[model samples]
Target: MRNFKKYWSFVLLFFSAFSVFSQDVQFTQFYANPLYLSPSFTGGIVGYRVAANYRNQWTFVPGTFNTFSVSWDHNSPAFRSGFGVMAMRDQAGDGNLANTRMGVLYSYDIEPFPDWHLRPGLAFFLQQISIDFSKLIFSDQLTSTPMPPTSVTQPGKDAVWDIDVSSSILAYSDNMWLGVTWDHMLKPVATFYDDNSRLPHKITVHGGYRYITKGFLLSRIEESFTVAFNYRVQDIYRQLDLGLYFYSQPISFGVWWRGLPKNSVGRRVDALAFMVGYKWEQVSMGYSYDFTISRLGLASGGSHEISMIYEFRLTPKKRWKAIPCPTF
Candidate 1:
């Protein structure tokens, strides 16, 4: 009876929420890659910047499940505004399901105080989702007991259209910054298989502060540190993350901890994240690893991510204020 109940629960969850329609890409280090989450983060750095990131997840499980993204952001110093373009592709489960998204963003900055400025931004997005019904394998018991021939064939590829809006308020000095953003203003249906079932939109709020301490331990070495956190809430899940970063001139390092909701097995799972990176001139390269601590750990080897970013000063003729190095 206990086994039957567990199986029933799994079936209900799978049909209701565990399917591909509700699955979203998970990021262990969102602060290091802000553009992946919010379009308002475009041009939050300085000058013209280009970034690329690749993520490999659930290595412990078989088959390929990975995601890749690329984005470019540029700010006009003369106009004090910015624009960006981004694209992403995700594939999972033997290519039975895939998702692709493209976005364009524009932002305008307002100077409220002598040293502080607020930026309001907007982004328009296009999303495409595809599912392969032919590749899906149903349980033998259900397939063998089919009542009608027409019921054997399932719905084929589903293409969906959706829109999202976001805004952010940023305040900064020479060395520190604080910002907040709300994403996915317009929730859209992802599952064309059933009109009654829809994926819930997600909301995230985050902020960070950085401090540069000179001559901390010795004259030659300087320490730069940052503390950051974010809270994300959705219909069925909520996550909280806290992280700290430390860096010297050439090499940077950081660690983070993420808390997850209790699972059906009554286990509280968490993840340990570590990052390392190097910066040279106007280019930076970084990588991060996440180790899961839960019953699913045996099935998921871990997760790996790599990112690269480049920034170029667009206004060569005008003398501009120095912009701090971007952490995201």
Candidate 2:
């Protein structure tokens, strides 16, 4: 049994290495992490906005994936510009492999026609990846009961740093919006060893529409239904999220389907996510859960995510056009 457990540990470590460097952390609640989604959303608001998000994936696993992000952004109505700062951290596996990112972004808004606007954005990030070599178990060490140090050469560096860049453009009106983002334009080198391994570029295209309905009893009260989709591709991996949302005052509900229904590469359905949110005054908070449906099944223990947003204005407030997108 001990030998069997050690073998699985080696298997887990091998897979974790690939996942850490090959894939980017994804949040089920895309809008909740606007700055992370697209730099064009940097200042997509009239006033100051702050957001925080957390996600835990595959809880049943020993070394689960945990990610966290925080961002702040605000728009300048006079200059028709937006600026923001963001940071994120993602960690996985018992080896304590981690990635940290910090960045600043800018966006400028242009009006092409009446009630329609376009935003172009750019961001620069500093990325760092680290791992604890001491925690790793080698194949030679597993051959004996009292594991002896194997003749393995260390990478010489505990962490690696790189500069990354991303750009995006958004076009929107009062009730509809569309955006596209190109990430990792720099193809930053991501390796702890002497060899060069570049992080692949990712492309994301997202859009949404909202339909507003008036309340029967109160004419002033408005309820809205939104349909949104986010499609992303990185390397050979493709992920699509289709979601429906309903918002009535302080309450919001959402349901999302991830992955493709019919694909030539076998069963593509990954998970179904459900979300609930609440807003009071200037603060909005949300929680979501992903139900794993793939071959991993329920044993993966699913994923959980939480997000919060606060919007506020400074003195001498000025009216600015709001981007028509889902708030959660």
Candidate 3:
């Protein structure tokens, strides 16, 4: 009975998450996971940049979801373009429902004016998703001791693999920027079931404006503040995120609100997030935590994310100028 109870409990939580989140994995620190947000960010770094990120969600739930990603990109002055590659994985539930992906990215930088520029990017990726059937016990997975003999367990195959493409474009200046991305260009049909269930294409639009104050923090460096907004839609779900950030040389602080106001209940408010970061020469690190505000409340265990990035030059190659963009 104890085993049965535990099994059912996990099944409930797992399906609940599946219904709410569906296929795509989301990041609270969107800026930290640049490549995941859009391919245009590929090679946005000056010379060469490498970055890694990790996220743990719903701390209170046993076997909750976790995601990790790594990427490397470089700017090419000769080609007037940039390229990169990225890998990511996500796992959830006691059944270990897993998704893994590898992708290649490319972007072209166009200067329309002295301080204004446009970057259009493209990405191609291959993905695989699978769930451990043995770890899951459906309503049919019960004892024969009683009238409910239909509860006997059975196993089934639930795996999918596919290739997808995405594209993005950005317009930026010294103090403001805007961009849009469209993912899952083919609308890949992937599901555990025998029939095809098309994964909805995802679209994200974002923009921000920054203001710098002379000598506000350090005599040699300036203090700056930025207001950012992001809106994303995938299938039937949509989210809007707004953030305010302050930066001074090597350090940054930010607060954000993530929500879907149209939804009823606590799920609509989602979370309020806080972040802090530091940069020293070639390396930078950032951390963030979300405070749950919706119905899930503290039971959601909130969310935590951390990231590290390094920028370097392999040799004294001619450096390609990069467009100024948000650092979130």
Best by lDDT: 2
Q: How close is candidate 1 to the true structure, as a TM-score?
A: 0.82
Candidate 2 worst ten-residue window by lDDT = 214-223
Sort the candidates on TM-score, descending order.
2, 3, 1
Clashing pairs in 3: 140-151, 142-151, 266-294, 266-295
Q: Write the per-residue lDDT of candidate 2 for residues 109-227, one digit (tens) a residue.
A: 99999888999999999999999989877666777878887545667898989999999999998789999999999988777767667889999999999888855322223578899
By descending lDDT, how would the candidates be arranged?
2, 3, 1
Candidate 3 local lDDT, 1-328, one digit each (tens):
7567557755664564355336488887787778888888888776899999999988898878899999999987677788999999988878788778899999988989977778999999998877776676455435444534334333365677889899999888777889999999987655565555666888999888878775521223356788988888887788889999887778989999998858523356788999998876778789999999978889989899998989995543643445444454
User: For model 3, how big is the CA root-mean-square deviation?
Assistant: 4.5
**Candidate 3 regions with alpha-carbon error over 4 angstroms:** 1-23, 142-158, 215-222, 261-267, 314-321
- What tens digits encode model 1's per-residue C-alpha lDDT throughout 1-328? 4455446544543473345556467666665566765555667655888888899987878655788888898887678777999888887775346778788887766667766566666777777766665554434324345522322334453566666555665555555555666655566556645555555666666666667775432122356888877767666677767888887777888888877555422344568888988876678788989887766774688889998888885544653333233353
lDDT for every model?
A: 0.66, 0.87, 0.78
